[model samples]
Target: MTAVLSARGWTGSTFRSLRTRNYRLFATGQVVSNTGTWMQRIAQDWLVLSLTNSPTAVGITTALQFLPMLMFGLWGGVLADRYPKRRLLIATQSCMGLLAAALAVLTLTGTVRVGHVYLIAFLLGLATVVDNPTRQSFVTEMVGESDLRNAVSLNAAIFQAARLVGPAVAGVLINAVGAGWAFGVNALSYVGVLTGLLLMRPAELYPSPRVARARGQLREGLRYIAGRRELVWPIVLVGFVGTFGYNWPIILSAFAKDVFHHGAGTYGVFNTLMAVGSLAGALLAARRTTTRLRMLLAAAAGFGVLEVVAALTPWFWLFCPLLLVIGLLGLTFNTTANTTVQLACSPEMRGRVMGVYMLVFTGGTPIGGPLIGWVTETYGARDGLAVGGAVAALAAATVAAILAFARHDGTPVSIRSAVGTLTGRRA
Candidate 1:
């Protein structure tokens, strides 16, 4: 009975990419760790607003948290290639867990100040500088060529699934026990992931070569990307969309509270619905063995359309379900764009390549968050969403035009099939 239950838990699909035990272990840890990470994120944001009632201040705080990624991401990519990914991840995760615990203590004791949150947020950002690229490269190391796409998609799916659980629980816990309790729960959540990482069979992990590149290799990474149209364009797309449109949660949190006059519980439900949509999108991507550029392009456009609809919807209750659609199409575009870049890059260049990819995805936020905040503060919440959607639409159209002019002969992908794959419609 025990074996049967265990087998049922690890279904054929769960283990599809887990012939490598290392991946299975990593996935298990991530499920726990990522959920905690999301919980902490929600708690932190709420805590910030509780301390400082300014929307601009919250945006600035978000900016500080991501600034390290913008400045040090290339260096982080270099570090990933220089060190063991698993070792780096273990250390980073431990540090982050401790940081959460410390914050919990401060907040619970009523000694927490806005300045404390800023300092801690900056430190956490610094840790993430190294953590993000290492984790991205680690995926390929675990699954190899056989199930790389599946692993990536599944990884995203779990992240979104945790998104659903984390904020909901955090909202309830914050209202009941206090925000400190949410942080404590998050601190505890890291234990499961850390344990999974430690218990993984080392032999099942893929061998990664620590290549010695010349000093000033950041420029080299830039030059490498400059020459590849296929690689560079998608990264650009992600940067624009991610920086602006992808900031729905942070922006919408304020909108829901200040503009719509909703409670924290309603805010949690809004995020939960978006997560549901995101999970569906990730699962759809996971089922596909290959990705197409056209699909990514179309999904990008669809995301913009959904965002516009979400922004224009008059009532809070009416706006909620549109967020789910936005989440769905947004993930579809994002995952396809991400997987395409990974599959296209050579192993030697994966870390650096993904660094630039992440740079665009994350780096845009520092610029976009402020702009969106300004719009939300000055014009209104609807204006912020509408403007972001417009930017996304334009970016998508630009990609379409490029696809029309470029010779895609060298690449396995073309414009038509790519669009069909993204929409899941007939080619």
Candidate 2:
């Protein structure tokens, strides 16, 4: 019996978090909800392209969707710490659903305009400012710290898996019915997550202490991050990569239309193929027991290099395989950074720390998206991709060098240390 049970546990090790009832429910709900989310994403991007055949317009839409995170992301973290995360998610999710529904009505009624898309995207961004942090921190409540990394990896896997399905389905719907139907489906999909939240067994939750109300808590969170080299470095790296490296929606759409001379169906295929690699990366991450700084840095650099090479590929057939590699490295870097930051922070401060993480990661879109869009618009798609890739690789190298200097000095590295090392002075 002991041997049999041990074998069973080993067989289930990669999915250990699902053994917890709460995480299981959360994961199930998310699978459905995430699929819908991806569908809407594909549909929305296609809709913008249809409304205005400019990649710059699509970039603007992406930027608007993420702009609120820049403005309110940290405050969202404060709320995550102050309130019950599950309840917070319900409110945010509901708001997002309604927004999707409203957009669907506009599109289906033939009243949708570029202005309407921008308005709804901004509204969705506002909801996500709260939802992103709360949903990220809530994993700890569902599955304790012992299994947190696994749970995070599993979450990424679910998201990528949804990516595989959602885009394909959305492509078909967009071609046959309309983009509006995709939005309508996404609006309905929120019910699954909301229902799961309601069904959760509160007693089973591994609750962390709610942060006591206090002044300057946000500043405290910032100070905490400033002091931790592990947290600070990864966050900085993600900011650069996230801003310049992960503008796939724009890049892929440009490739499909301009380079490949294809339509929404081909765009969907690219996304789906990329997700295949992403899902592989996420599953691989799930098997790892720890997050390493070296792995994060290496993956980021590799992702950048891959993108650069992919940009230079002349044929769509060649581009597809390159996207697979890019997807794998991109997801690997993302999962490692997310797991590392969340695991490194104190429970009381995880929300705010993650808030900062999300801010740098998504908020940078406003700055990077338009710049990349302009590059693509002015120079061409390949040049735009190359620019982003070069910047991402350069950022990784800079962070890696700083980290090496810090290690050599046997201290947590900062800007001062980097400057001192460069100038040959004591830091």
Candidate 3:
């Protein structure tokens, strides 16, 4: 009876966020849109690789897509605060759909070039700068504070679930037709999101008051983060992990084409398996009522350790399962970091806080993508992945030390002892 009750409790929690009507609608749209997004991701990376026969070109595409986040992500958060999230999302999502359509037309018409890809990627990045933060902060409006964490976890799960379907379909599409069809499908997927957004009842939303336009708004957000030591460490940790540890498009593609001598099918399979693990991790995260610093740090360390293991394996069979574990730990770290930052800040500041959080988290991709791509090109895929894992692991340790320093009472404790205190074990 006890076991039955426990199982029931866990099962119920896994989909608790869907109880809210608005969230259910939002999620319904996201599942389709997210699936399309993943399809595009796989298709885009593969497209770049085929066009140039260079992993570096793939990295350059990635860099171009995320470069705007490094430049204008925070301002996006400012807009989220100053405007209604739903309305902002409508505009951004429309822009994204149009961009996808344009790319599809180019690729389908046989006039596509690497230069055209670079430009479209940059335009998409511009749309994302606003969309990312507003979408994140909008969750608070949908489910309120009580279910915020669950919604975030479920959102991750939904995205990963789509990932499972997206890449597989993209692989088939690429093989049977061409990459252009995948882009076309993704462009159509936006209809789901737009429909959901349009159907939402304005009265149901828990909207934050719009901030009046003022000078130093951007600086204000920075100061808000600077004053909170607790908030600072997670951002720092995610920045390093995101920049170094999350270059899968570069490393995995290189492994598929150059190292394993496989084609699009194997690449799609690798992504699907990782999506399986990511979905599991997100579902597990949703069941939890709270998260601790120890859990977040542990996930970060595990992700790094597993990436190194994945890099070292010479057998193709062994490499596949390693990606699953890597995906699980990676998603765990991301969801925890995201929920932590959001829960710690006040409502008025939530948008900017999430913006800054995403800035470091994804903005660093531009720098990491090209560097890792070059490393793969020069030293082989194995060494490139190993280098990234090392950096991530070291960054996790550094952040752990920072946490120790911040939390230590003014006692004469060694760094090791302080670290032990945070991890609840002897260092």
Going through the candidates in order, what is the number of backbone clashes in each?
Answer: 5, 0, 0
The per-model lDDT (C-alpha) reads 0.79, 0.89, 0.89
Scanning candidate 1 in windows of ten residues, the lowest lDDT window is 1-10
User: How many clashes (backbone atoms < 3 Å, residues ≥3 apart in a chain or on different chains) does model 3 have?
Assistant: 0
TM-score of 1: 0.92
Off by over 4 Å in 3: 1-11, 405-427
Instruction: For each candidate, give its TM-score against the true structure.
Output: 0.92, 0.94, 0.93
Ranking by TM-score: 2, 3, 1
lDDT winner, 1 or 2:
2
TM-score of 3: 0.93
Candidate 2 residues 105-138, lDDT tens each? 9999999999999999999999999999999999
Query: Model 1, residue 109: what's the lDDT?
Result: 99
Q: Write the per-residue lDDT of candidate 1 for residues 213-286, one digit (tens) a residue.
A: 67877887788878666577788889888888877646767776887887667777878888999989988888
